[model samples]
Target: MNKFHGIFKQLFELQLPGTEALDLYEGYYAQLYEALTSRDNYDIPIVMEQARITGGPVLELASGTARIVKHIANAGYSVTGVDISDDMLAIARKKTEMLPQRIKKNITLHKGNMIDFQVDEQFALVILTATSISLLKDEEEVECMFNNIYEHVKDGGRFVFDLLDDESFENSSLRMGGIDAITLNQSPIPKQFILMGEQRDANHSKRALMNFYSEVIAEDRTYRFFGSTEKTYFQYDAILPIIKKTGFKIIQIEKKELAKNEMIYMFVLEK
Candidate 1:
């Protein structure tokens, strides 16, 4: 496995330590869904289309926290949500366990890396949304990852993903400078969260150094945790070639405006 897959594999390896490190991820994952679903729906109609095409089972890659999975299941489709986060999966399991029997009967949660996860049966559609594809760090791995998705999807099945636009990628990289912080209201205990991103490459492409920090205030003690992740973005101009190299024909590229004056693109593909 490559470094990207390796990181996810380590994140999902079944163990308590795996769960502990993932606690932070679980918090963010839930917060993300709460924030997104509260305003604009994220791919609800697209997912509903997939549900209709399959007539039943849908496979979701990098399905963090089962937010979308629960929605898919509630819509009457059987869903298998796969993610490489034991911490996230632990919370997913608990949430699913608490569901009514009807919903619980149609959902399955698994610990698997996105690049290598497989099941005995082929799916009608496979989806990677919310820039989950961005998690893979570079081009070679991106190619490998797409190939894996193509391999797993059925002959007539469709693959879908959402990402930033190429033009936007260029525009942002040129004037990249920002420091924005977010605070999540839902926490196990009182906490303050801050994410500061510094733009590095300002020409050709978009690249940013994302620094994440969280301050937790327990009853008597205060703790701080910090980590950094680098995001290197691509334009649609640069990305289509890579998608074609893996035999994925881009069926549609839809763009929509977000509340924050950002345009998002969704790429729909088929084998």
Candidate 2:
């Protein structure tokens, strides 16, 4: 397993309406989300490539901190980002404020859910990046998102997303302890992010009851974060049936390796 792998993306909250981290740390969690996502930008470049295909508007689900949204807009694409977390949207809005007026005007942030969002017009490209889809409660939510994404996608447009493949899930036991559990610390500022997580069997074998207890020590301040959720774990062969049932038709699927034992399944689908 990648040592810092867990630390980098571990802060991903289950979904919108925010999490206990916000209540405990107030604006602190949003800042951390920006810091972590800004540091790696796990999949922004690939998402931008998709944005380039259609010179039309783009919509991104779970667009936390508007990290991807800002990048796309800076590239001269109009982007509408929808996310549920107020803390995150606030940061996204704040960050865009400093951009050149032209770029700033190209980005829009909406406070909403990925499962059911309303927009008058459809987009030429729809994206769900950063493996945020994994936070969906179950296959049903996944379908709900797909169905909604289908509605938003224009004819001949595409849907692109990546999932952390289940290849490494069998080793969850090795990561269940605490922040003491994983470390990929290379930050210049002394940082302390403790993720207290455990993986346990859910109602279904491919789902896990995830418990989160996190604490963060910033460069000069200390904060605590917390949350609990039951999230779907994906295995390609096992979930293929679910995807096949969606309105989208898979056009291409590929795998990208980030670190040892860490692989992401990137899927491109057409409406």
Candidate 3:
């Protein structure tokens, strides 16, 4: 075992206290991915603490629905978010519209892939949360992504991100009851079902698709969106060389049990 820094426990509180079962509604693809995603409000505090620790303007890559970035903005930090999907950005934009004017000006959203996304400004911290980078799977993709992150990060700045390994997800299929949402600026997500499919491999890389049959109930209205999220085994050892070559030094590596049987490896890298 290796230890880099003293154990720092209890950063912030978690919202997903586990939900009690309730009857679900019959609906379609309308829910904004809050039910089964990090939007469930459990992981938000961890990422928020990361921002608080680093204390700077943030540049978040692969910013799906711009969840973490939005929260960072709400906390009074300036943030620039980049994502590849227009559909995801649209949902994020809708949420952004509901934020206060001051917070609205604090956030900037860009539609672009992680590999080649360009922003005019550099940030004191660059983040890739929700384990989104792990879905890249390919070694080259990971390398390119980090190289791009280096360019957007100022000297002596840090990059913090999380990686999820599909290998930890044991069940062939999994189910969770309706999560009681934490309200807006936080989420009004409702019921959801996630089926983690079998992993497929090619050229020593693995890919798994998590199919969500969602039935989300917002506060005032009901909406539902069924979607598939991809996960790939993130082999940190395989990418360590690439990361160092791109000029990032591993400052700290922390492991947290985000959920039962779900381990998250958070890498804090310094440029």
Candidate 4:
């Protein structure tokens, strides 16, 4: 078996250490999301331009913490943000509460699953940004999500999203066995955290699983350790047919190369 499968099996069968680590890890993700979106240029310009062309009301799937949706609403579009994680939506609600009434009035938050959801109205633009498309684990889930998106968007409306290219996964170091430290200056727990893991694909599916363990040392030298696993699937050739089958015509594709042998692909599709 591949290293990822072995690690995942271990994680699944064993009791993880530090029950509080899950809460801390969630807090870490919330802080990271906030910091990434606080920048002026995060995902605002690209999505805003699409919203302007397509016209609103806009719907954002997997709108974690309302990072991009809030900005889109602030730009004067009526926006709805949907996320399955209530913790993330709670943070989004708190942030939305602080916005001006004009902007706040245009924003709505929903706690729902993206694969199966219904809205009272259709949208001119539907978005799934920040590599959110990869969160769907398999072809069936992707199909379900695209069908829902099709239903939610008006005819001729636009759907836009970004994904991490397959090349990145192919080129990545699958055996991350040693300590990997990450430091975020803006995070409340500013000290570095250590991560170790491996990523590998499943035998019967295109899905890839990443099994990781994280540890951090607090200021007082308290040690917190956490274990987590994530699964995502993406391939340019494989996903294109799926999108086409869902009745979306690909309009534009943008590619960006990042450091560490990673790449990003942005796709704009029309219903």
Predicted structure with the largest TM-score when compared to the true one: 4
Clashes of each: 2, 1, 2, 0
Model 2 misplaced stretches (Cα beyond 4 Å):
1-27, 169-193, 209-223, 259-261
Model 4 TM-score is 0.82
lDDT for model 3: 0.63
Question: What is the Cα-based lDDT of residue 68 in candidate 3?
Answer: 82
Q: Sorted by lDDT, highest first, which candidate order results?
A: 4, 2, 1, 3
lDDT of 4 by residue, 208-250 (tens): 5444444445666644444444556477887898898999999
Q: Report the error of model 1 at residue 80, Å.
A: 1.3
For candidate 2, list the clashing residue pairs, or say none: 178-181
Q: Is candidate 2 or candidate 4 better by TM-score?
A: 4
Badly placed stretches (over 4 Å) of model 4 are 1-28, 32-42, 168-171, 174-179, 185-187, 190-198, 202-205, 211-227, 258-261
Residues 160-183 of candidate 3 have per-residue lDDT tens digits of: 888764445532122121112223
Overall lDDT per candidate, in order of appearance: 0.67, 0.69, 0.63, 0.72
Off by over 4 Å in 3: 1-32, 41-46, 165-196, 202-205, 212-230
Give lDDT for model 1.
Answer: 0.67
Instruction: Give candidate 4's error at residue 59 in angstroms.
Output: 0.5
List candidate 1 segments past 4 Å from native: 1-40, 169-175, 185-187, 201-207
Q: Candidate 2 lDDT, tens digit per residue, 1-271? A: 2211233235453432323433311365456456655755657776777777766699998888887888889998888999888888887888899899999989888988989988777998999877777778677788888888898999988898888777665345433443334332445435555454545353366655444445555565654455444456666775577677876888778787663345778888888
Total clashes for model 1: 2
In the order shown, the candidates' Cα RMSDs to the true structure are 7.0, 6.6, 11.6, 3.8
Clashing pairs in 4: none
